[model samples]
Target: MNIAKPNSYRSGPDDRGHFGIFGGRFVAETLMPLILDLEKAYTEAKADPAFQAEMNGYLKNYVGRPSPLYFAERLTEHLGGARIYLKREELNHTGSHKVNNVLGQIMLARRMGKKRIIAETGAGQHGVATATLCARFGLECIVYMGAVDVERQQPNVIRMEMLGATVMPVQSGTRTLKDAMNEALRDWVTNVHNTFYCIGTVAGPHPYPTLVRDFQSIIGNETKAQMQEIEGRLPDSLVACIGGGSNAMGLFHPFLDDPSVEIFGVEAAGHGLTQLHAASIAGGRPGVLHGNRTYLLMDADGQIQDAHSISAGLDYPGIGPEHSWLHEVGRVNYLSATDDEALAAFQLLSKLEGIIPALEPAHAIAKVLELAPKRPRDHLMVVNLSGRGDKDVPQVGDILRGKSK
Candidate 1:
């Protein structure tokens, strides 16, 4: 497992955070100062070895760094083609990879002297993670979630509340992740003085897309080292689901330079691409939203369209700006999985590998199922199991029962 690092894919998003014309600061004039201040603080924090040591200590002692890269022997035998490995992010505290970014952001918030923390969540994983850290640090936490998500992901919502975080449900628009983000932005603009907006994904303004990616890059970094130790080389390919694309980016960023490692990003196709779905790159065009220019679901009149997906986590109308740029540059292959396909993969992994994946990562597993069988048995593939299915069991059960009828 010799590490093959490519230098071609390392550089990105110049000083202005433009990932080749995709990402930039497209925020309100009033927010510019705050964004700049955050960027400067983060730049300094990144340069300080003490900051890195502190974050590393927390990651190891609290959020559980270096999540296992376990080979799914049963699933590999079942597929009988490519060898499959699961990057067990679900094994982390809070049951997801979302904690990786939240912990880093919250640490930065504390360092910035901000007393209040505000965040937006789609499936409640990010909300729960944010709440958990705020409770740990005794910082005020407010999480904004869509009304629909609040109902569908009640367990996580309850967890946030129990952790002493206020959950505000936004009923506007499609009553989903996009609307929740809008409301969260409003809160940030109104309370900029004391509030530090901790974006859940790598899709916010300039510094945010860069900042979140750097924090979450730990996933890719760990995977590289673990795979090298196990197999004596890097994986042949990597796969992960994308909504705002943080987890996928985290796993993909470090491997970007590895030309031999094929990267695949799976987007949620709710029903089908022609109908309701959250396959942003497949069905979207370049547009500006949530402070960055990226591929977005928009109508002919340039109005944002409603996105739908069975997985609450991947039900967004747009993706991370870096993904948008990567798509244009032909750096990574973008694929999609329907709700039915993801559901089937979810059950298959639970039965074969004893791993019940969250619906979000199920999309990636679905893609692996399709590609693994076509490749040679010696081909190595890794899928980022971004979260556990504990929070999705009830929703999946209801859907399964409905299908039985």
Candidate 2:
């Protein structure tokens, strides 16, 4: 069911960076000035035509803009219902949607005269993008990754190193994405002068959530034009997987006010929502973590709970504040898929469509297996194939071969 359209769902995070009560600057006193400075610089750069032109040049020649919105004919026929189109973000340079935001941030960092770039990553896609951009811009780059992730996503760690980035593995907490972010934040606070924290997702404090979403919105923006060209009408549905929810937000924001479009944000259910899983909105309550107050997985004493997902990128304990706002208002339907289901979809897409999707978007594809078949044949559905599965091949191979669980 569609929620009645508001005056405009696009207007959000009022002057103080709040989306209702969900998003705000919940940072340490020491970082406030830096955050404010970033906001100011981003505002000035946004208004400057030269900044946009420079970023556009790099996006086209470097990261590759307007990645194809191809019809997944084989997969759609296999499902036998809604017409499915895959937004091929996986074809982007560095092999994910992360580069779209990094290019913008790195340019902004240069404008602000910041010489160092630091970031945190779980799946390594974002870290790779940041390192690539820093290397291109001749800036010092450091990436914090969980010790567990550094072990599992070894290929990405190597990629970052080759790009001249120093990768620090955080061993605290669950030794995963959340812990890596914790270390990155501490580094930002201590070295707040020359260091620029290039957040990978849309879950950070204030301007970060806004900044990342704006950069990534190109996905939805391009999809709109491409869909019109292909079908002569707006799409009926949009789907993407959510960890910290940047990719989903990227695809959903541009269409939020379109009541005709039904949006779904799929979260990874590692085992099951009732078991050890990463479906935060499904299994958890509202709380604060990593500078923003949003939905998080926590315990009786309000301590954070560990999250599990087959996809390293979707294994975070919380979601973006804008997602929380959308969830509360019933603007987007949030669904989830188990690891087993995602694995099945992963294999199905590879064989049927010859496209290897990253495990994160596999969660969305798993749901589409059910959702598409039920819709009419004329129903147009677009799914963001957010990244390619090359990085996941090793882990998936081990699981499928019964060498590891």
Candidate 3:
């Protein structure tokens, strides 16, 4: 099937793997053929309304699309910068933005006649979302997560289990997201004929980065419409926390062509940017993970390093290629927020804005604190409240209180 080439702004280089120097399909030989197959299918599917309609139905009925784009008046006033609003993705069904992309993949799995779903998670939100979609569609689901993440994010682990997923704890490698992803890829290669790999971010092989973006783009679509209705103009800036960068991409993709809209991605700087316990933006060097070549916190020897953050979801060694692309193109600014700052924002939003954001989104909030005061008080800024904070309370409380009593 032949479709129009990716418009100039979207495709990577011919020889260079890039989403403008951010995306390239770098993979092991074993997965290359399947990755190419997925690329063809996604190219065709993206241009087909039948495929779009089916996924759109799931977004509306299964994942609850059109999540409210809320104007956080008090939050804006408190920031003392341009007026700020929150795309309340935390209100989306399944409590975060994961369901949107998962719904699309689960549907594609059914289309491919796949009977099982396999996925990886850090905080397990993506795992839970995938499991929920499988349960809705009557497919078997399995989730692989690092043993460390399973222990740190106990609540999400329980949530995934309750949703009928078998949570497989990976014990090898640093026992975190990257390791968990490695385990999931092994499962996918082993079960390639009848299993679907539901990636959590706008990453992985060709089809994955494109497919996930198309699904989650509803976030930005709604934000644009809502902003126009209320403000009679576009937002001046956009911000989201980056784990593997799905949420950030979803919120940023629609505005990519709108150069006037400033964008920022806040990475988790666990302690401080210069400290050992951090996953700051600059901490990672450009490298390949899974199927895509992107920025990763890897050593000169090219071994992936263990990433650290109070937010397990943000504790990955790399980010999505699209995000890497955006940063390199100068369309998106990458920043960092320390653990203390994120924790403070988590509580601050709860107390001041009555919106308790997940640790990941709270990192974006921390950046907002830095950015708001620097912009005009009336400038319009939008932050993606990616998920709810209930899952983070126990761990955050322990950190605040200094060890268990």
Task: Point to the candidate with the largest lDDT.
Answer: 2
Worst 10 residues of 3 by lDDT: 1-10
What are the Cα lDDT values of the candidates? 0.94, 0.94, 0.83
List candidate 3 stretches off by more than 4 Å.
Answer: 1-8, 11-17, 277-280
lDDT of 3 by residue, 1-405 (tens): 132334444444344345755566766777777677666666677787999888877777767778888878888888787788999999878899998888878877777778989999988889989989888888999999999999888999998888889999999999998899999999988877778889998878676887788788889999999999999999999999998889988888888878689989998888776774445357876787788878888778998777888889898878888777666656679998888899889988999888889999999999999999899977999999999988888888887788841
Alpha-carbon shift of residue 120 in model 1 (angstroms):
0.4
Write the number of the candidate with greater TM-score, choosing between 1 and 3: 1
- Pairs in clash, predicted candidate 1: 1-232, 1-233, 2-232
TM-score of 2: 0.98
The reply for model 1, stretches above 4 Å from the true place, is: 1-7, 403-405
In lDDT terms, how accurate is model 2? 0.94
For residue 365, give model 2's deviation from the true position in Å: 0.7
Q: Which pairs, if any, clash in model 2?
A: 13-18
Q: In order, how many clashes per candidate?
A: 3, 1, 5
- Candidate 3, residue 168: lDDT: 98
Q: Which prediction has the highest TM-score against the true structure?
A: 2
